[model samples]
Target: MHRLSRALLRALPRAPLLRQPPGPGRLLPAALRPGSRGGLSTRPRREPPAAPQRPAAQGPGGEEEQFVFPEYVAEPGPAPAREPPAAPGRPERRPREKRQHRVTGRPDPSVPPSGVSCSGCGAELHCRDPAVPGYLPSEKYRSLMGGQPGGSEGQGALGRVVCQRCWLLVHHQQALHMQVSREQYRNLVSAALRSPPRHGRRPLVLYMVDMLDLPDSVLQDLPQLVGAGSNILVVGNKVDLLPGDSPDYLKRFRKQLLRSCAHVGILPAAQGTGGQVARTGSQNLVDVHLISAKTGYGVEELISKLQRSWKCNGDVYLVGATNSGKSTLFNTLLQSDYCKSKASEVISRATISPWPGTTLNLLKFPIINPTSDRLFRRQERLKAEAEKTEEQLSDDEQKYLKCLKKQGYLIGRVGRTFQQQKSKAVIEFDPDELSFSMEEEPVFSSNKPKERVEFTYNELKDARWFFDTPGIVKENCVLNLLTEKEVKLVLPTHAIVPRTFVLKPGMVLFLGALGRIDYLQGAKSSWFSVVASNLLPVHVTTLEKADSIYQKHAGKTLLKVPMGGEERMKEFPPLIPQEITLEGIGTLEAVADIKLSSAGWVAITAHLEDKLQLRAYTPEGTTLIIRKPPLLPHIVDIKGNRIRGSASYRTKKPPPLVENLKANGTNKQIKRVSKI
Candidate 1:
């Protein structure tokens, strides 16, 4: 019966299958088709044809009209061009306009905004790359831009913003590593100098150099950079780091510094005629003042000189090499009468650290107008304070001065005028801000945390500014190769205590692993006084074993500085030796100074007839300078009797602190504690 049925179906001429209309009772497709296997066959379902529209009525002209549905209408433009297919395993990039924004609809904060810069370093603010200068994290940037919790509420908060680098330096005493070339630093300074001043006046350049580092800190071509006609005030910073308080020593040091400056072409070479000053180009060395930015020694005189010589004629720029105390001086000046009273209250402090390249940008504060009225008020305040004897001073003032005496011999306190005192009372002090005052000594304890002062923009837009330019990185500075921890060990915090050692021929002295001095040839034993941070340990050994000892002790506790043991030593540059020959002037005087980069210097003292030949070793690529007429010629006298069994000498006690102040045409003396 099945075969008969199949034959009958096949004979029916194989009628074409018709799709059922859309309805609830649509029949299922037959499982087996005629002349096919008895199994269900898969087929694509077809869509129903669209319904036709009714015809439109004829017009008065009696012509029949056609009708069209809205769905059938085509767009009235050219088709969009298709994008090419992406390559294998790569993401397809979309147009920037169609891409999602990083922060809401706003532009990326990592891209610097127009006319915006960090208040601390003056680098253009960006949040993109931490490896670059002026990098701030996005969240912190949002806070600075008023988009997050700690952000500024208005334009007034602009001056408070600092880049992450400066923030880390100022608060955590940590520094971010950045690879900035010396040429790049020069370009930054050149660009700043090329910019026209706001009032169209020549700017005064305050050329600063480290007292300890000598020529390395002195810029040889300063006159050329600041314009030959510009006035330059050569400032010697970190005087407190040099031992001895004798006024005569300071005078001699100043003369030696001037000569050194001349040697480096910063000043003109001395003429053969007499002790007459010669002109180099049109630039004049306005004056050379040695000051301790940390202890405020000679800072007041510096400010007075600024007011007297330069006045408010133009803006003042502080320029120097890296780790030369430029930022410290800036901070000191900001709180003193040098800065405008209103501006000082609003301006932020620069980041001061032992790390090289700490100041990578131009920071500025408005200079105070040294008008007769303001000068008179300042003089009166100083006179009032000077009139008071040590007995007359308040207990707090007495205690503060006592503490300062231990830090330096010549300390100057920042005195505020009546108006400033009155204004200070009205302004509320933020407890969270860093406590900076002439009275407060620096505390290094980690347990007692300190905070940074918040700042804002100065309202006095017309006032002249005191610019703090980026420090020029010295090519041969040892600090450049040191880690932050090692730097702190090398840089002096407290007053340096001169450590003298008696060395004979064939003997070697090591200043940690940073410097090595060998008395290779000498007629008699000589006194080698070390002028360096007390934190550096001085080890005396025979020249024969010097290399072996250094290799074994470097990066260990014996040679403290590069303190990561074998791992650190592997990366550290090997010590390179340089031969130096010097003639002795006198036994009491230091005939020459062997400068071991920024690590420290060794002042050699020998008999008048002694002609000493020495070999000095420093890290590869570091500077090894032989400074004649040593900075402190009488440094040998500053130590106590030699130790009985060792090559070391006892550190002499610091001299008594005395302040000579003139009051009512009479000189008055203020006494502080004699010893710690």
Candidate 2:
């Protein structure tokens, strides 16, 4: 019956799962019922509980179901520090008491037995450490301390006793963590001595410089840092940011870098040519290499150098600025796995955020060489010491001090001056305040010029005056005078209106009465205005004694004021002569009014026929108004075009002496008559 029931259920399309079968096998045992206990019911007996229904067996097309289950993670707690047995032969020195003593033999207090000889004058050590007598912390002790200071809740609850020598040594080895003083930096021979790492020998030192920031001032002291024998390789690390991939562009960059170094005082390494090293004049004894850390392009060359040169597998110590990717390079070198087991370690005290200084007091590890056992060290310890010293010193000392103090001061003092230099201030007239008049109308020889719009006005009875008024504000407030390029003031967007000036032909305008006053030989005098006026392309006439001209020479030379109603010329007798001395030159009256009909125009004709060669008409192939016409000025064939006839002697206006010879004479005849 059960087999037949199962077979029938398998054939059904969508049947609800039953919790229990209404059969003898589905009933619970009699012992489980409270009614069966002692043949009496303690509570009313209920039907037996049904079993949980199972979902249908899943296949490729089955509806997937998920359920949240609590995960049980069994984390093994903090492991105890492993105690490696001390080496067999080398006897460990007994801890000595703290003692203060003078240093004599060696320059560096932290130098090993090998480098302890005096750099200044070769001498053997009298006291243990060269610079000072101090104790260094043991590797075991540093691990025990775990960066916890001698205070509450530390591994050393009572703070373990350490000698000054041991502590200094430990600090030197852990230079990456220590802040070195300026005194320490200056006195020490090598960075290693100041902050030696656990490694025994010097590693191939890579000196990375930000090309833009390196000044000769800072680079002068570079030789002292790495020393003479230690292979100091210089690398300009941001080559990727340089402009363009062209060989010429790269050459320019290299030349600029070399020149900048020379300016600040760094010598570069040997240059390569045609894929071979060549001796160049600018090459320094110090090796120089260019690389871009941003892209991992030249890093392999740097790694190859590190692998080849560093002795006793010396530590690859990268030292540079905060943003220089020192840590990134470090991580890359070590394949990013820092901890022996865990993914990351918690750094307690950080010099900077996100990136922390090396925390290991003396990170010791051993590597085997083909010949014997060796240790490869990455000495970030000295960098740590340098950082400490850097913090203690003023901020600019590392970067800008040399630039400001040495180069800036030198350049500033090279050319000294005692006498005050004269300065110029330009004066401009307000268009509204100006009034113009022409004594005579300008008559064109040709058909009325289509390019030039001409106008005429009556001559001025009084001498023209030009004034220098400062900028005007909306409230009638005037701002100080602004230079040509300067913006006087920012106006409210809605209130501001741009000004325009119109120049009319054959018109002389009286500006305001003012002249620029400047300093000369410490005295307030007008000289710059005089000198600068000569420099300006625009014609400017001084008005220092112009008023005298109105009193002296008014209407002397056929001057006339044409009234609108009469159109008559009124002749006046001379109050004074035409010439007067002011500023520097003995200036004469400008008989005719001046006007600029056009701002200026250059006719761009192609000469498509090629018959004229363009030169027959224009000397420059395009004419300057002051030099040639269709403008007023007479045209002289400067090139003297062989194809065209010699230019006629035509003048824009005849000279003042010849204006009276034939007032109605043609301009060409007037020019010829004046020349004769």
Candidate 3:
């Protein structure tokens, strides 16, 4: 009978599921009850006795069909600290107590051992575990800590003491990554500003800015934190990614930078006929220099300038947001091919890597050149002497020429005496030579040299001493938003070759599945140019297909925005959408640029006919910033054919601003269906 009943149900069309009440109401209507002639019950006319009410039971799907409410959890309390047990033979090392200044080396009757800072990476030294940073073997740590600076004649006595991790990284170019928090960065910036320097040296602040990711708001914060006593030198790093050599573009960029800095209360340097700063009406003093630490472009001149200006022994503090190239710049500043630091000899422990937070602790390296101010004075004397003819010289000048002859700086030699008198390979300086060329090849810090120093930050004596601090984790930068591989795709290692697209109404452009731009409604076909890492992929699709393509290919192929690999990244989060409406300041100005946080931006070329509308999409919690194109040269170029349909393209476009668009969408979707 049971088999026959199952067969009959299968033979019949599917019936709708029904909810039955408790007690007498539990019985379905005679016509609708199961096992009835027609899904109805004839025997159900007899009802059961009253019973205690119970929680509702699920239907056929059981627990799979029902949702259980999760228990609420309160906020987390302060973390508890645990100390690992010690092994025999080697005693357990306790957490380091606070100490006096590493630079001053003056022991506070208050603190002991000055808590070990890795002479290599500057992390506090420890021997508890090899997996953690600043780890050293117990015996090695004792030997290093017990030794004195310049203990013996050999370089090993004065060798740099690095953690085992830094030693491996320097030798093998490996990365032992760390996740740094923003609060730690705030502490470092505060310390850099408030920490007193050695007696005679003034604190010269080098605030490094990542040219590609610098926002206007960050520029403003620089002045407030760096107190008025310090002179601020802004280094716009990663010029290797900036495009073009057009004077017109540079002219525009200079003005834009000046304007932005002025907006932030940081003024350009005081103006003279040939002064570095032009009167761009700003309150605080600043000098800007564009450099490429990766390529060693413009760094030499910057070094010479800084070294010449502050003749007084001044402490140079390198401060910048994470991935701002501060470590690279710091390394380059200390690189010397001369006798002291050889290409094969190990020197600094400041770790340089694409991985954010690679630098955990503050590290310092002293570049105590025996002849300091004398090098600059000699260069000045040589330049003056080089400009004069042999007959145009006085007896004193002749004596100088004779000295230059001894130093091999004659009419044929251009930069033979450049680095210094004590430096192994000197600059060959010839009177007729227009450019200064090094006698030996130029050395770069990127070349991982063998280990050399055992010294700490204590050896620096006020002479442009470089203090490397922790990297600040930026919240919106694609580097922070994307995973390690994704960051490589988004950050340009070489010059950025640009990509551009032309989209009609209803078309959308997906930037490596990380971001999307919908051309909701425009006067005509819209042209959008993109400038970012050449390695990052871009794709386009209709608004209807964009959602499906993104949902399907997200992490597998469109891998830019996903935070990690595996199923989590493949499950692209639903985009948090926003509609941007643009308006022009001028009657004729209708176009504007919209930025996608650390991702590149798009400039909308709109007609005055109607205000353009743009719908932007990004992962939830990710910041999407819209601003005018920055005053950067070659941020965008229209030098490519319009890309349409489902293909991706590249072009160069600078980031800044545009105008006149009406945003049309809910936070979830635009929901606008315009005429096709």
Candidate 4:
């Protein structure tokens, strides 16, 4: 019966098992309820009369053999409530900040005891004296007053302070700020140009051309300054007023300007009665392009080219005349939809402005290789050479050696040792390293008698490194009367005495207004010839801006400017056909349809037979080479997919975009879709 009782209690309800306590309820029948699975009793039932249990025997190891585990009694628990899903835009929770009191400086036993003078009074005392102004009562007191992490010794490294009254008198005078004069600013520019550092890569010069009157004063010597093998992109400002649809317009203008330039001994080839002597169908060279910075039309192309050049570690400089939008271009390049800024930090008293004559200053910040201390040191030395006399001991050089300085780069001084104590001395130094043959003679023609001045580091280096100086100095004597302010105003005008000046070489990049050729009333006096004759570059591109300027002016009685045998007459219907072929490195894909003003039959088609090529021929069977494409490396996508050959071809007009249609003619029509 007792065994039966134990087995029966095992099946009793769990909730009431402990409460039953071997009472009459333990024997109840309904203790097992349906669907009460986990709710069953966990407690063992107690028998009214039970036999005592025996302990298990120990094993050979003398350890207890067996044990019975205690049963768990379930207690009543609170029911859990359902929670709703979180909102989509809610931010994740973050940990809180911790605030703690930090300990100040501790005493270091290694440091030696030293005495300090007090700024408050003339008293000098040991570190331990409390009465003296310089005294610190103890290490603890010193640490508290020093307010340094490492206590008294660390504070002492910062140097001793003066007595309060003395300190106030010493610092009472307000610090005066002096801005760099225009002349000094120009000198600074001369310094930078004289010592432009090698960036380990070619630099990119954004050659900006004034769409209207490109002054002979600005960017007139760009070809020399930018150096050979440098990427100089020409961008024409102010194009919003011109027609953008005509593609051939720019080409015709280039041909006309090239012809005009040839007359003045500026352009490379002379134009005959016919257009540029057809090269017997040889390959056409890469050409310059037009873009209006004021209108933001071709800026995208310029940015793309700049980015590509920068990828190869090229440095880009904004070069242009005053008010030609150099600063505007910088702002435009920096501005985005997300963040807008005035970007006025570019300005400093010695800063080079976009204004003509003032654009000479160039600032270089270490963006790529910051670890190159030696590189910067070499560059600084070069700059110092531009400011100091030839063979003279510069400050940095003086730190190591003692040597008599020559005027400029030569070995000579102004006055005699006794009779003529002070006289004018001029030193001409070659600032540029790349151009070995440049004339470094410091010519002195003094507006006033020249004077000698000792060269200092911070005073000259700071200006030399930051300002723009683009003018040529004709003289060498340093004028005593001209203050820094007076120099600043005259530097831009190229009117300063050249004798003691940091002379800058003139550079220029000309843009031939190809599309505007026909519209030009005085093609002979165009700005292109002015620049070409002066700051001539090895390479030039005539950016065709119009479709057919000559064709439109053809048969009209326009004034003719004869360039060699080529006449800049009214537009003419050329007997030659309009044919263009573009060849480059990779495959050429698509081309636009050609539009000829003369209206002659033409055959135009594109081919990918060997790489990508575009071929065009006239009805008379004349072929023209547009350009040769650049070779590119094997291209691929992020997903291991291949990227097809890319080429953008433009003709008389841009190509129109086409839409795809379904095989079934049941696709919705454009007019029908508009209603929805």
Candidate 5:
């Protein structure tokens, strides 16, 4: 059987192996058929037949042309080379086509560079849009930039120019409506507070709070914003607004401010021993001071303290909420001994106004280095001036002092040192400079002429600066909701004259259309002293007519503020009531103060045995604080005798300058001391 199988295999012709039978139209060699032996054969393989081409077509010129499809034709080219494998421990590189487009660090070219900004508000100077902040007329801007003499070799000339908005605010006492969001204001302050590593030391934060607006002016997150260990000096501004010069009352007021700070978590709460608590609090809170930034009452003392304690250790930052007088204080310091003599001559003053967000940038001046020689000279100068009587002062000094006295009884006059006075004449005058005298009192029309100056680049380099940061907006403040005209009437520009009234149970008191208070339940009639802006009118009526009176008189001439009439009333927020209960301490002393947003506060005085139930109303989204052991507990004494045949009392006027000096027992005596 094996011989027969071998003979059959040999007999088979040399044929190739076939996997399947051929179809009818296709043919295969007989040796390669499906029934043939499954053995390898030595025969060359044949190529498949090519597809047939279509017939040629006739062209317009009667020439023959063949149609060709590009997709079907294979291009004659070499294959692409593969990339080499990456080495061990190295990342594989991506192809150039797969890589993403790279971005650059250059600033946008579309935004025009600002070579100049408003010296008062620090807004970029532009003549493109008037509705925006920092807008200036085209002609005025061109004149300031190109026509001004003594160009200072570069952009330094721009620092001397103020925007149109600030110009109107300073000259005509008109405020422009510029709204700043709370987050943006906070960002500006935070940027000022953050010290770079090269600075070596943290800045001294001069945290200013408004005396009239208590807890509301105090920023709650101050400790968190500036580190917990930061050095803070709590400064109480606008003390002149209060009607008192007594040292004891001022001391009590300072304590009240410290308590408010503690309540807001800016300082540790007083506990255990009083002395120990104070010592512990002093670690973060270096000190607390009360000053009137407007009248310069305690600014000199504050400067002396700053020079002694801080002593040019680092930059000093002024931080506070809006309308806390940060800009006013900055302007006062710019012309004082706290600033370097050379820098003071060059730096322009910041804009001072009742409107919030007046300062929008970090306005700064070089801090004077407190060397031993400088301190000795300062002390000697102060001693000589203190010994001299009012007769010894210059005519200018006397006139300035006289004007300051009208603003506040306890006032300090800013004076220059011998060196500064001698150097002042050397400053070159620019013909095109806009000159205006600083207004002694915001309420008065008179102004003393003074030339403004600008700082050069060489003057500001590598110097420790005293920075004035933008004021943060208070969340619960009513000023945020008011118009510019309404704000002027609400915020005080001069000393506040206490207006007192006798209100029995079921009577109501209205502070313009902004605030309302009802004496709902009380045993006896109470004395309610309204410590508010003199411009805001006070009206008293029965509780039953309170709603009707507001409905009829709000936004009208009777209400005074929100002067647009019925149209303004439509946009104004409605009053919301907050019920409060208090126990009276005595008729002579106020038990508590009901703060109605920023409009003003009312000090409630009633019999010791009386239990008072009150309903305080403020605009919606506004805060109403009832403070115990009121800031001015004995404020009722500041008023005059009660008016005859009426529930109102005559407001007391500020005492004469001579009487105030004598009452305070000043060491220096004036020969020409007389009442104005």
Candidate 6:
């Protein structure tokens, strides 16, 4: 039965599966063949036509008698040589222009849209590559540009902005610091100084200063930048970082700023309006207003002042140091002023980072003024309000009063400083226009001192534009010595929780790796209040083992707050240590202080100064300033007590931020504080 079944299956081969079809032979037409239409059988493959041969011709230098296909064939190329790989060590630049859109086949229902550009940085935006700056998902880009998410228009909005690089740095807490060479800085500064006013109208300057980082070089160099005649509004920012609000402290702050400026010969320019002025020194060109950009404390007043300045002058320049909070102040002002500020946030017009030089190129923001009808009503309201009594003013009217009051205090302080020093007569200005009013002092040779602006403003139609320039980065600031991570840890993010350390003669203290202080002499067991960031990592050791401890634990054990783990700790150079011995009879009995440049300072209060040695250390290139302790009030002593007469003021936590500084020069100058 099995044999019969196998034979039957073999015979039935055709029944199980069809046999392979035979290859086609020369076949008749479909009409002539069976079961076919009027068509020929399968079409035959055809070979490519060969190039026609030409008769041999006599040639001058031709080697081949018969011209066969040429050995070397050349055709026009599509892309340039750099189409794929860029030169090594240089970053590949994206093309400014975009490619054409791609259309699908057949129905062509799905077509790739044209490339979009980032409104913020001007880089072409793309949804494909996630690692690059302009990469954004099609849906997110649309949403950011004000379109609904998942809309059919997956193509991004023309007004949408913010490249991926800025997005990450702004929102993701990147430790990126933007550094430019001193030459570049100088060029940018000069351009800003020489920026021509729009419509040939007067240009005003918003001189932003970091109050906490007072006594800076830029403050002294203002006269050189804007000339002695530019209208200057001294915007004192980061006031919230201060520990106290005592009236006396405010006065001291102003004087310190004036003194610093005076030392550098930055006397204000003579005023435009000749008025009966007091013999205030050449400080009238400056109008100081203290405010906290982070907390929006004085932003409202600043905005009002800015608006008034705009109406008075067509051009306004916002200038400051990299870490002086210019970017923060800019963002805050826009958010409060512009209708499309949300769009600005998406683009992060100017990133607010702890790192200095975050704002590199010049940025322009437009101011949209109200219509004439609305402007007239607003003007009437303002004029009427000016006539109203202070008691009748509403909350909104009083909101900016605090900052407004500061302007007067600053003026009074400057006057007092001039009264004491008998320096150049201080010039006073109109508080509203910031124009100097110096009728007493002769106008320094009357030809406008060659600095008077040539622009004239006949009619004010709401100044439409404001310019922002990159902040200057000073070289000697201790903030420049720290790593970005170290900066976040060392700069106060909240109210500074003053850390007190008890020390005998042989004790040493380290302010991270940036600064080190050693008490070589312990006179009367005096108390020193170490006021610094709460996050600062401090290690106390005996003076005998201080050097070795630092050598072994430069960034590892004793100084370890960067949070980059052990690997980062290895990058810091050996701390540059310098010791100053106070052996004079005065050194024994008088109290002396040591400043860590701009970071913080240490005061050695001893009845017996007996050979007190202050061994200061900094990063290799950083400058160390050991000056008289800052004349700040409200200091606490070791017994957990505040000093008499000056009560300590506890301010609210500061906005999370870090002071940024960059080195502009390599020259090192060491200043010592002499005992008073």
The whole-model lDDT of each prediction reads: 0.71, 0.27, 0.54, 0.29, 0.72, 0.51
Tell me which of candidates 2 and 3 scores higher on TM-score: 3
Stretches of model 6 off by over 4 angstroms after superposition: 1-158, 175-180, 217-222, 245-247, 269-284, 308-312, 337-349, 368-462, 562-570, 579-593, 603-612, 629-633, 637-676
* Predicted candidate 4 versus true structure: per-residue lDDT over 289-369, tens digit per residue: 445443343454454344334434344555544434454454444431101111122221221222123222342221212
lDDT of 1 by residue, 1-676 (tens): 5565677677454544556453433333444343345533444223334454533333323211111212212222533334456899989977545432232222354344424567777776666667668776766566556763233452334556787777777667777787677888988887777667667677878888888888777777665667656667888887765666354666766787788777665664335457776676466676788887877767776888898864435888888888788888998888888886655656777777778877788888877778898889888876776566666777998798788766665565665553343323344455545565655654443443223344344445577778888988787779878988899988877667787877788888888899989899989989998888777777777777788888898999877878999999999999999988887877888888899998999999998989999999999989898887678778888877764456666677464343424333232223221111
> For model 5, where is the 10-residue window of minimal lDDT?
63-72
Candidate 2 local lDDT, 188-262, one digit each (tens): 324442345344554444455543222211244445554544434566654442222122333444455455455
Every model's TM-score: 0.73, 0.25, 0.60, 0.25, 0.73, 0.56
Which tens-of-lDDT digit does each residue in 1-676 have in candidate 3?
Answer: 5566777677444443465553543445544554456644423333433443422323322211111111101123543344445677888877876552221111222112225566666766655555556666655654654643223432243245676666656665455554345776667766776677665666777777776665632444666666655666777777556554243543444455555656666676666685554544323345677666765545544665565555554666777777788887766656632112321133553677676666777765554443665566546744663455544657885574454332211012112233423335555554543443544333333544533423334433333446777666766454555555566666666555555455567777777766788878766765565655555556666777777777667776444446344575644455789998764233222255566767666655554455667899877666777756533323334344422322323232332110111222321111110000
**lDDT score for residue 428 of model 6:** 57
What's model 3's overall lDDT? Answer: 0.54
Per-residue lDDT value at 13 in model 3: 45
* Residue 625's lDDT in candidate 6: 58
Question: Cα RMSD to native, each candidate?
Answer: 30.1, 42.9, 26.1, 35.8, 35.8, 29.1
The CA root-mean-square deviation of candidate 2, after full C-alpha superposition on the true structure, stands at 42.9
Give the Cα-based TM-score of candidate 1 against the true structure.
Answer: 0.73
**Model 5: how far is 48 from its true place, Å?**
99
Candidate 4: C-alpha lDDT? 0.29
State each candidate's clash count.
1, 27, 54, 62, 1, 12
